[model samples]
Target: MKRIIIASVAAAALVGGGTAFAVASDGTDSARSSSTAFQATAARASLSDAAHAALKAVPGTLDSIERDHGRWEADVLGQDGTWHEVTLDANAKVIDQRVDRDTDAEDAAEAKALRNADVSATEAARKASSGTVTSVEFDDDRTPVWEVETVTNHKERDLTVDAHSGKVTQAPADDDHGDDDSGDDD
Candidate 1:
């Protein structure tokens, strides 16, 4: 009788453990499925019929879709040598639109100007003393500025460039300039 009782208890524990493992596995799978379904739903909701139609209208091809700043953006190139940036909502509804001759062209130009200015500034600083470029950044209000941190033989320097003009305007006398103090710091 004692042996039978012990066997029954051991069997019960084994069965219970197996059941618990199965339940845990099922829970994990369910959670994963739910997460995937949610993502799909969100993607579908982000675009509206009109937005979809607009995207299809773009000439070249649908290059890519991305989420930026809580908005959906589609990159499309028109047959007329124009790049269209379509912003949409979570429901795929068109929120805003932009047409650029070339995407990132403006930014590239700005960056080039900035780099040239940096080179010029660095040369000037070298003339004065030796220094290294640490970092570059824009200023408040999206001003394209190069915040250059240079460790000169004499001192560290910080420089700001104008986003529109790509000109180096100011340089800090000290290298202790902190990180980008932008509103998006958080």
Candidate 2:
């Protein structure tokens, strides 16, 4: 029943017929380019040693990562079990850092949930798609799944994997994000 809910959510989030990707036949540039872009992002992600270095600078457990506004952004769980949003430049220099928006209670819950995840972020990204992992998170599900984001072929993608079962599902792109390239290097 839970898997059913998960599948339903994914089908609604990704595409018709409970599929993980949009078929080329869909003919929407947004749809087709997303996959292509993902490939591009994935292709390029592995080359960013700076993002990795920025991640290592964080003083705790790592959470999720993603590229936004032309920079590699990450969420790290500190040794105190708090989440921090960190950004790194192309040279891997830390350009910004701050505490995550979640409340301390939320942080505690996420930290506790992190221990049960059998799949690491790198493994989860590889299983979801061929790219560099940008971010990872423990979903708010009762069972707690891993929500991982990756960049490949100059595209972005989201994948959800069961923390214990290793079940993976690719999500559809929702670009309605009100974010902008304020931090992007122009």
Candidate 2: stretches off by over 4 Å: 1-51, 100-102, 131-135, 150-157, 172-186
For residues 3-120, write the lDDT of model 2, one tens digit per residue. 4654455546433212242232234545443342111111123423544665577766556666554456777777766678888754456788988775777667777777667765
| CA shift of 117, model 1, Å | 38
Off by over 4 Å in 1: 1-54, 102-186
TM-score for each model:
0.29, 0.55
Q: Lowest-lDDT window of 10 residues in candidate 1? A: 17-26
* Residue-pair clashes per candidate: 14, 22
Please give the lDDT score for candidate 2: 0.61
lDDT of 1 at 85: 75
Leading candidate by TM-score: 2
For residues 85-121, write the lDDT of model 1, one tens digit per residue: 7777645677677786555666445434443342322
